[model samples]
Target: MTHPIDSTEFASLLCSRLCHDLLSPVGALNNGLELMADETDPDMRQRCLDLLADSARTSANKLKFFRLAFGSAGGFGDAVPTHEARVAIEGMFAQTGRVKVGWMVGDDMLNKLAVKVLLNLSLIAGDALVRGGQLDVGAEKRPGVTEIVVRAEGPKLVLDPELRAALAGALPPEGLASRTAAAWMVRSLVTGRGGEIVLSAPGEPMLLFGASIPG
Candidate 1:
């Protein structure tokens, strides 16, 4: 049976997920600052500066992606520029330097709901590429529906069972956790809008996620 998650609990899970992701880069920024304050060697100081810059960029990129994926971004408009979503996805994977993103979205703009679904699924699929890989994101609008697809191909891909269950909306409510929050959110968003999410078979060489939402 499918379990339902209340809004309050779901919000808390999302917040936990955001904090967990930000912790590493934000901690690096702090460490870099501390090192800069104590380091007297010119070269060491330059290295610290570089680390600080990289960390700051990573933090900013994560925030931008999270803002769109989990927060109230893109203003009050019902539609958001597809370019923003593409940029957000690119920024999200750029920090790892392991994954390459191919954006095949032809639509100039998509409804805000579609953008959210697109980014969230892309995030999940990209993360599954544990050993780094190619992530291709595509989206298109039909007469009465929006379709989004994310494909991940890598040397080593690992999609956790809990996440898979969450995406399929089969996880029990008590089984939900921060790690599976994004997957749950994707399922919720698509299904709530009278849509469906599809996952590639477990033994597939590559991971594919597709969502179709009716307007």
Candidate 2:
């Protein structure tokens, strides 16, 4: 069987990916600038150095994870490792921010489309609970097909309007930049799969039929 939206354009996708990685460094620079202004003593500068180093490392690790998640971890033709996807999610949270990512879903090798789809959805769920909430992720495969299902769980979900809008592709997510990027990433991956998005809300527990995987 042929897939409808089975491929991603690397050049355009690369832009999406670069958008995600640049944030950490830009944010770190802002923090570093603040540090530079606040302290005059050498010891204080050293402290700043440590902070900078930590932030840089955090950014680097996050970049690696995002590259695997949003960028091209493997070639377009290759199946992405499900374990790698899970690890990338964990790594994103553990290194980039403070979210504690918990996996409820078992692992299996997923195609590139599935990896990117799950990755973006996980980010959306994590964003919904920005105040450090637990992330529950799960997955299932279509009956004897290459299709797959993925999900994210959390309490007190914070669904950004722009993110949602971008998910629908109703408007470009220029305002809620990061959230927008996430929205675009997920929507693009899911849409690129020629699938539909089934979204629940902040008040809802389960986001059903979020997307239909292609065969």
Candidate 3:
């Protein structure tokens, strides 16, 4: 059985996810302001403006989706709406860093921990496709348990060692912090539900993994 998480751990991981998502936009805004302030070239300024727009769009879209994924859309002591969950996934993928997002999960109202598992698994998959590729999100529910799977298929699949460690539950603080904090949240939520996660190798260049939560 998995142990429960304390408020401190929960708060720390949640804060990390928010900060990580905001950094790109906030950084872009700062850079755009600076560029506009001095050394303004028509072409260069346009590029800066474009960068700002891209960053803002990415940040906004991600936040909108995260509100459902990370928020109480599901498992807030009440059943979550299937359409809302679908909308959450759709909202999250409005823009891709370099890769595309694919949806394959059947619509369902996931419990809170199950939602976190999917969210964390997606976070890991998103990072793996840094060079641009496709991501697949799917889930399955059986009596007494639910399984959420996230797969990243591209020409290449990269798995950070620290991520492997964190998934194994022996994470080092420094290395753990460097990873998307959502990873930890996923871990916490899954384990709290007496569940486990499995990450497979990129055979033929595909990263696939899933988390199972007790029903």
Where is the poorest 10-residue window by lDDT in model 1?
A: 1-10
Best by lDDT: 1
Model 3 Cα lDDT, one tens digit per residue, 149-195: 88887776787866765676656454446354566667767787688
Over 4 Å off, model 1 = none
lDDT for model 2, on a 0 to 1 scale?
0.64
Clashes of 3: 0
Q: Candidate 2 or 3, higher lDDT?
A: 3
Worst 10 residues of 3 by lDDT: 172-181
lDDT of 1 by residue, 1-215 (tens): 34687989988998999999999999999999999999999999999999999999999999999989988788998998988888899999955789999999998999998999999989999989999999999999999999999999999999999999999988988899999988888888888888999999998999999999999
Question: Which ranges in model 2 have alpha carbons more than 4 Å from their true place?
Answer: 1-21, 24-46, 95-97, 144-156, 169-182, 205-209
Winner on lDDT (1 vs 3)? 1
Q: Rate the local accuracy (lDDT) of all candidates.
A: 0.91, 0.64, 0.69
- Candidate 3 wrong stretches, greater than 4 Å: 1-10, 33-50, 73-77, 82-94, 172-175, 178-180, 202-204
Candidate 2 clash pair list: 128-158
